[model samples]
Target: MGEVDIFKIMKEAEKRKKIKEKPILVKKVEIKEILPCLTTPGYIRFTAQADREIADVIPIIFLMFPPGKTNYSVKENTLTLRAFNRMITFFPNGKIAVTNTRDKQEAEEILQKIIDIINEAYRSYLKYGKPSKETIEAAAKLSWMDIYNSLPKTNCGECGYQTCSAFAVSLLQGETKLSKCKPLKGEYFKNLERLKQKIGEIMLNTLGWE
Candidate 1:
């Protein structure tokens, strides 16, 4: 008879346990298109496709869209918004388009993060006939136009920008604050406050922070 080698057996069991507990990294995503950004210099656009069917998630995304930075069209079955400083569009065919990425590496990273959300939404839909509201709300964020429209439109240069649109873009980039808009008041201030809240919520939701 041979020795049992109990230590080796235990080590093997522990390795298997750790492997089982580790999350499975998604590998079924493919980057479909990579293009230069026409509107924004030094940025690129990436279009990606997931192997699994995600048509079921489009409507849930539309329903849970957060205010300000998000736009959803039920007729088109599409949702367009900003996330991680990139413009993203969720389509009905399990495909997504993200613009304004810094580079291919950054685009890939963003797609992975996006795929994580998609997987969560798909799983939720399969199990409960609905996607998680938190996931959808976290994924969608405000665009520059969304923020600009809510500003005073004074172009007062109090925010150190030649135009309110430029200031709105800066706010999205975290380069400035709403407080810098000295002339902002009344309804514009109220809108600005609400947009800020939404942006904060999205940051917390996506970054896994409280």
Candidate 2:
């Protein structure tokens, strides 16, 4: 099979496992207040919630303005926010979704915490706007082939792999450790650390990390 096929298989297996898992219950929630902002050409409103502990487990929710023009859909924990220019998909821990334009005011009054985060991200965007492609590419290129080649070519089982190529694939997927190569000790190990930092930067800047 091709490398892409292998990656697809791994991703499918992971998705299935995630799907089988149940989400924790979020209860006794209250929402209040709404602040308006723009998600793109369309405007958005901040909604707040009270009496819930859904933080950290889910993505922040926002109520889009001119509501029916944008749609928010949820399947299990995954939430997709669709707008004219952009589509954002995330898993939300809170029991909140963007309401249709007709219910805009009511939805805003009920989900207070959601309102807070939307406002924050909006303010950040106004100040910094979107991150540049050059910045993102710089982060992606942080890791070099030289560091990858320096790894022990042996497919030693000590790293819990039958082959070095397998380990390299894992590294690219953020699944395996460079130290597991065993032969890459000292300065070589340090270089691996640097490469990881770069990879992490890329993942963050590009929103590629899950």
Highest lDDT among the candidates is held by which one? 1
Candidate 1 lDDT by residue in tens digits, 1-210: 999999999999999997566443234778988889877898898789877655677655443333345576645768786667767898877688888888889887888788766655555455556544443443354566877877888787877899999987766555666667766544466774565455444332332222
> Per-model C-alpha lDDT, please?
0.65, 0.43
Which tens-of-lDDT digit does each residue in 17-95 have in candidate 2? 8745533233244444443444433445433343444333222232222122223232243444543233433334444
Off by over 4 Å in 1: 1-27, 63-65, 131-210
TM-score of decoy 2: 0.29
On the 0 to 100 scale, the lDDT of residue 206 in model 2 is 27
Worst 10 residues of 2 by lDDT: 61-70
Scored by TM-score, the top model is 1
RMSD (CA, Å), each prediction: 9.9, 16.9
